[model samples]
Target: MDFERSLDLLWRDKGETPQPTRGRKPKLTLDKVIATAVALADAEGQATGSMSQIAKELGVGTMTLYTYVPGKAELLDLMVDSVLAERDLPGPGDPLPDGWREQVRLYADRTLTVFRRHPWIQGMSMVRPVLGPGLMAGQEYLIATVSDIGLAPRKAAAAANGIEVYVQANAALTAETAQVEQQTGQSTDAWWGQRSVFWEKYFDVDRHPAMTRMWESGGYDVDTCEAVDEAFVFGLERMLDGIEALVS
Candidate 1:
């Protein structure tokens, strides 16, 4: 598909049209279907889980699941929303005690934690905005926190979206890393180590100066959350600095 069509599937803002329920009446409620799907994802990874697998786990036929969720896509949306519900939020007017940067740090950490626990959630979430309450509340909290830094509602919403994108992108990369490890029975380090010789043989130092510098800087260390956090801090400061300059 084209970029816009792919983005449409990712953001899914066209409105919440429930898939027409079909097939034999399921003994399962929507909640059961969602919950089972979530459980299956938790255990097997999102890509590994399928409608048939989920139905078998719930002791229902695949057709029975179709009655509740329009298809695997809808089921994924429900699973994401359900996972979001597990996240805790700061209370109203609790005062994001440490200021905007700290508030954002905590927010990103919490989001990352959730994605780590539910790795499949990263895959499911990027598919659409289901207007699910949990996702809405999380966004609302981010906007409110940004407003404390004196951003107007529109600006705050935009900033919150940017932060959300960062968190999701990081989690997606990490999840892919895990999947690679699972499939190859090798750590990312080992895989890269095996490829380093090939890269060294073909990659010219003069032709890709910047990439050579980055590669020489010891690339892709998994035990570098601190480095990642520092980059996140740097990016956030840049964002806020740009906003401050604009507002000033």
Candidate 2:
């Protein structure tokens, strides 16, 4: 996607792009176009989605959409930001949690909530970031939260990013697990247990000492499907612990 093109579309409401009127009746709005595209993506997978498909769903010619959104890439940027705006991150003057750890947790939890609601987001690469108002608000929240603590400016920003990376990675894993279940028509637990024969027949304790030790110690007792969430929390707290040590 063109960098300037995305930024223009993303900040269009802020006057970055022209909002000229096409018809006296105004048949469609940018929000309507983006909303319809989001619904289509939510129903079908994002990879399978296209501008023609969205246009078809909206009952308009595909070319008509270009007037409002530049293309699929820009539309995707809007769609992601639209969903992200659903989060309830408070404004600067609003009452917020007192503890820094709680503030960080709030950001992580809200982001994961968005990911679960829109599993298709797991397919989008946020490395470039949407850079829309929705993402900017989140970035502000994290930066402000960590900056209030005693860490240096860069380290605080780094801490926020570190937490974000862990959250996104786990969110993607959760989405992948759900996608596998949907595609195979088999529950994750059932599919995992189906591979028990591999552990029993091909298992070699000598070759995999760590696994053998963990298994013998009942570390593998939990249902992995159910444990994915627990694993996320465990890892998140460990990361938080390191950050807290920095603060101290």
Candidate 3:
């Protein structure tokens, strides 16, 4: 399917929600609590947000939050799911036509967009299995799309892993960039440019031919948005190529 057509379908899927009420009331719901926590995290860093903080924002006592979420861990999980629930998958029968590559790229892009907005997601590193319905739904979409390419279940699973890893890696890098800029008061490009001059003067170019060549060629000047798009496509394509070898 054309990209635009696929996106239209995805948007329709993302529209599955009722508008939140504006005024405060006597009762609290898990949805409202999660939304408050998410907004708090968006405005302030996630580390600074707590049940007490969110409760104050919502004009409730700290203990009241527990009525919605059992504890902070559950609150965090709810926050993550609240964000993930906003993601859209390609609609039924609207799967990418170029095999798994396009599907993976689209998935990675959508995921990166979410992580970029919520950079604190980088702090969530666990080997435990994903149980959140939102996350499970995303994985299911990826597996089903990959299965459409005539890939075996195992290979498709691996391919999905590769796509998710790529997205997470990029999100981590983006978050680090933001962190570095905040600390040094310099953009990534500015910081790198200032450091590169020192390196060129101190190090022998001949010692690292590949590094020297890339630096001299100004290859690091690649546009950030374009680089992200290219990386997702390149990595997904190479992964799919490997899977095709295995499946065929």
Candidate whose TM-score is highest: 2
lDDT values, one for every candidate:
0.68, 0.80, 0.66
| Model 2 TM-score on a 0 to 1 scale | 0.89
Candidate 1: tens digits of C-alpha lDDT, residues 1-248: 13332233334445763442577645766777777777777676655688899889999777887676556765665577667767666757665647766777777777767776777665554655665666876888787777756677788778788887877787666666565565567876677677878776987889988978876787644344456656656776787678667556
Off by over 4 Å in 3: 1-26, 91-99, 179-185, 223-229, 245-248
Worst 10 residues of 2 by lDDT: 17-26
lDDT of 3 by residue, 1-248 (tens): 13332223223335654222243343776577778888887666443587788999999888776554556765676677657656776656765547566676677777777776776665665245234666776888777777766766787778777766767687667665564565467776686676776785877877888988997798756865567657766776787678778767
Would you list the rank order by lDDT, best first?
A: 2, 1, 3
Question: How does candidate 1 score on lDDT?
Answer: 0.68
Alpha-carbon runs more than 4 Å astray in model 2: 1-5, 15-25
- lDDT, model 2, position 117: 71
Per-residue lDDT tens digits for candidate 2, residues 1-248, read: 66686677678778545562343344688888888888877666453578898888889887777777667877888898998887779769888887878887788788888777777888888897888888888888888888877899889889988887898899888776666666567888898689989998998989999999998999878888668878998999999899889888
- Between candidates 2 and 3, the one scoring higher on TM-score is 2
Error of 3 at 182 (Å): 5.4
Q: Considering lDDT, which of the candidate structures 2 and 3 is the better prediction for this target? A: 2
